[model samples]
Target: MDKIINSPYNINAVARVDSDNIVHNHIYHYCPIGRVDDNNFIYDNNNNVVGRVDDDGIVHNHSINNSPIGKVLENGFVIKENALVGRVDGDNLLLAGAAYLLLIQGNR
Candidate 1:
């Protein structure tokens, strides 16, 4: 979790995945991406637990009132109840059929 703070690799905020968004040297195209706290927990605007990414590259599901919504494996495979849901792309975005951004909706 501490690595997230001093992330040697910067995961810069990007413009929303939209065609209108130009994929050039656009500097303003940024979203208030969620923060990974010291405790390694991500929360939504409603103060609801969203998810977590630990030092092991394991993304733990903390959604559903902090219940086990699912887990995103290091390989980006989302598993829920031992079933494969979907996978996360290079952009760290999941394309699950029932996908919902586990992060907060807007700027927190």
Candidate 2:
């Protein structure tokens, strides 16, 4: 199954996560370092470990002292600093930092 990450208003697709757990947009692609599940580190196209999703659904940025950057709530909403930034459609992967990986760092 594939997960579609949409904008806050659910307008456009921000990124598409395929069955292999690889996230891809027109400009960039991010893949998991270990397994395709929780507690796994996410890497960018350059194979840099950008962030990670914890078991609690919290997204952490490795470059920023592993701070809690965002949260993937149980309701499928992606929250960043208490604001609705994006949403995941389909079975939640519980990837701690997938939204932050695609929305913020993926743009860099």
Candidate with best lDDT: 2
Alpha-carbon TM-score of each model against the true structure: 0.36, 0.75
Q: What is the Cα-based TM-score of model 2?
A: 0.75
* lDDT accuracy of residue 59 in candidate 2: 84
1-108 in candidate 2: lDDT tens per residue? 777776668457656667776766622444332223344677665667767878788888777888888888887778888877777777765653355443364455
lDDT of 1 by residue, 1-108 (tens): 011111112444322222321111113323333333445465443555466655544445554454445555656555556766444444433322112233322222
lDDT of 1: 0.38
- Number of clashes in model 2? 2
lDDT of each: 0.38, 0.64
Point out where model 1 deviates above 4 Å: 1-40, 57-69, 91-108
